[model samples]
Target: MPHSVHTRSDTVQPRPAAAASRGRWTYRLGRWLGIDVYVHATFLALLAFFGLRAGLSGGAGAGLEQVAWMVALFGSVVLHEYGHALAARSFGIGTQDITLYPIGGVARLNAMPRSPGAELIVAAAGPLVNMALAFVFALGHTLSADAGQGAFNAAGELAWPLQFAVMNLGLGIFNLVPAFPMDGGRILRALLATLGNRVRATVWAARVGRVLALGFVVAGLFGNPMLMLLGAFVWFGAGAEAGAAVREEQLLGASVQQAMSRRFLTLSPWTQLGELAQRELDMTLLEDGVFPVESGGAVVGIVTAEALRDGLHDLGPKGYVADVMTRDILCVRPSDELSGTLRALHGRTLAAAPVVMAGRLVGMLTPRGVAAFMGGPQLRHA
Candidate 1:
């Protein structure tokens, strides 16, 4: 909880970095157990397609009923993700958010449990939730056979309980397939990590996953676009996971002070949008045309290029930099390890981080600087 100050003498110029956001398009379904649930845009399209197809086949009533079943399926998917979230929580790993996609639910954990035993529990919990749901639904269908009708309704639509049971079973089985970003692959990684290096374990697991994905792609060659897409996702996801594992290992011995940029520009809180607008016109001198906002020689916040442009349009060039700056941003210490620093920057919009120590502005850390250090020569050696 202690803070560190960043100084100008430690500055290192930043490099280029890529960025993207997915949470923006998601619709919040609800929050529980201190976690938010989101349904992705594509999920709604899936529901619309299923409902329309059912309407064409059976009518409005059938469409509504089919929609209900689909809802139950997604509800089960949400439950499955919750299983992972809760289990990860038990290990002190917080989830970022849970997002439901057309294929299934994804529990985005803030960080994965490095302990093999902890990971095993988290990975297995998801499949177990589906199995439990399958059991409950199967029991309901059996008990309601005489009263509510199990298999066929008067409209010939498959009844809810039985349908849900089968769907849950399928979900459980499908997720157990060994592929990256899936439970089975995580399970595999954990098991292998128990026997050897974590990075090496990830590489082996990724290889297995890519091989498994190839089989799916082969099967998809005949048809099954969904499976083909899933296979492609698995292949790429596995490669990414492997790369992340290796990257983490490489940065383990490095510290933030070793790579943070000390030569970056700063903006004054009193600086008007006109200054930033002018700077934006010739951005060759600034990385990403963004600068940390300093007030009274202390880093207060950051002013980004986009904010400056927007301010210029809305408030004209007279808008103060403070008006467009993002305040209350997370700061890093000079002594912090590079890996922890990178984790702090995860899912953040602004890739630049201000380093502070003893309540004084020190230097700025940027993803480009980190990347350069990792991929290029060491500063002192160079």
Candidate 2:
């Protein structure tokens, strides 16, 4: 059975934004309906592994047939993810990309719908697609059977159409297991969110998911290694979802002013990359790598230590900071909620953003700074 994972765009970790943006270990398949699709390298290995196993048991023809079936199944998986992306699009949310992995597919949405109803619709879309596919495949199987075709092929295996139909049906039902990070879990969370705070809902959903995951693991001990893998995915995914929900809740209770760095270095647009690099070396203790560029008494852009190093090496140390600085910068207000502002920064995949008020740069905010604040005594006690 195939499953879909939804990733929120705002969940940025303490890593280089450039590194975070790169699609590592995945090959671009192409784009459809303004959404890019990628297949992980491991997916191919999975196909090869299955093909080899089938070949050893049967023959080359069986191996080829199995590979074709797997491809078709994953094609259905892709459509499953598209179901999620298109549904989110209807809610005015954009998808970053859809990547197919050995386990299943993931649709990275710019943001999850805030409304419970909207979230319920988005979460249910994928399984609905699978169920719809199952119906179509079942109809095809019925038609083929009525036309004097056997359910099993000459190879004594189930007909491809029947297999597809059963697989889609299983996919639809398995994903509705109400496990956190799964469609059913999201549906449960959405329904629970209607009654109270979303964080509490998420916590409840995660607890249920963990229990189900443990059941899966125990059942897998009898047979089915795939079930074991799925159990692990559910276990870890639920924990992550619960943790993120709590972190988001904590951020919502704080303001940018409480977490932002009040003391930070600023640079002139005319500053040479060489000079900036030397200053960066001197300020080795500085935790923040981003520096706002001020020109004519206004913040113009921002540059990172990575950019400074690259500029020095590429432009021979004489390149102006303006040449390398990013002009399209995300700026947050001092009064803005840290949660929302952090989401904006992560949506843009920015490493850091400047805190501006009254057209003046008051401070800087980075994921690291936010982590420090989140770990501080004030939030710790709360």
Candidate 3:
């Protein structure tokens, strides 16, 4: 298929202010090599600092060359991310977009590959891209014996060819380390997944990642701060991945009925506002008003706090809940899977939704309820 024809889906809304802040330091565009890409704002600062350092330490000539090399280095990072995106695309998974952060590039795939083998390929493709670049540079260096070894030396003064080769090689090698948020860690998870269940594999891989991350932290505190930051990234990434794995396990065979909140408070149409405030609304610990119950076969919609406050002014304390209640209800059936329900929540602007079954409201599924279900100690198993 033509790369430009690749399909895109709305995974999440972009925060304009956040994107603006990020754009100041990096490039932002759609369709680079037929893939959407974004470069964060910090990449500029990184380039500027290194460029100035090279200039001050060497000369204008050296600085300009080094800056060019730095750009190429990040360019390689972009290619690495694309490797993953493209691999995922081949499997019919969609890539939201690739964002180049200060640390590295991130290709936000809509969902992880369901198969372990596919995941291994997607994860390995990135580091493989770096390896290819490194091989090309190495071959060039070897074929041209006239080129001095000084150009390849990391300890020596900044040189474009040497820095480029070293960065590419290092990136390829570093990403192979089995740590969370790194390609190696993903490779580990995929391999383990083939031998066991995904959740178990995730748990094992995450544990290994945490241990490796700690090793990096200790090493960084003694000498390299960069290693420390990378360690922290790995640590948190592993924890988050583990938690997601846990949630996935719970959602595997369960539906909305299993998790939705029962015994929810509801306000009857024509009920006095004062009575609602005293009975249904006040009893529930939530600050939000009760779900307005529909009458005369009408759908019930949510009424905001402002609507109730306004009703008080016009209808007095004796006025009914129906006077200010909204009537456009959007709800989901109890049989729907939790993941599908979560997706619906994102697609809709509703803060809370009623769960219905057999033409009757069975429960409420609010943001708090979902969070509680995900965070609860009891693990729902298949």
What TM-score would each prediction reach against the true structure?
0.72, 0.79, 0.79
Q: After best superposition, candidate 2 residue 359: deviation in angstroms?
A: 5.7
- Winner by lDDT: 2
The 10-residue segment of model 1 with minimum total lDDT is: 1-10
- Estimate, for each residue in 219-335, the C-alpha lDDT of model 1 and write its tens digit: 888888677877887887777677766665778888889878787777788988887666655565443545789988778898667677788799988889888888967788999
lDDT tens digits by residue: candidate 2, 1-382: 5354555523444323321453577888999999889888899999999999999899999899889989988898888889989999999998878888888888878678878899999999998998999899878788757566678877898877778888888877888899988999999999999997999999999999999999989889998888888899889888877876777677776999998888778889998878766765655524347788999988889888778778889997789999999998888898998877777776577778899999889999865678777663222110
Query: Which stretches in model 2 have alpha-carbon errors above 4 Å?
Result: 9-22, 147-159, 265-284, 292-332, 337-350, 356-361, 374-382
Q: Give the winner by lDDT: 1 or 3.
A: 1
By TM-score, how accurate is candidate 1? 0.72
Q: Ten residues in a row with the worst lDDT in model 2?
A: 373-382
- RMSD (CA, angstroms), candidate 1: 8.6
lDDT of 1 at 37: 83
lDDT of 1: 0.74
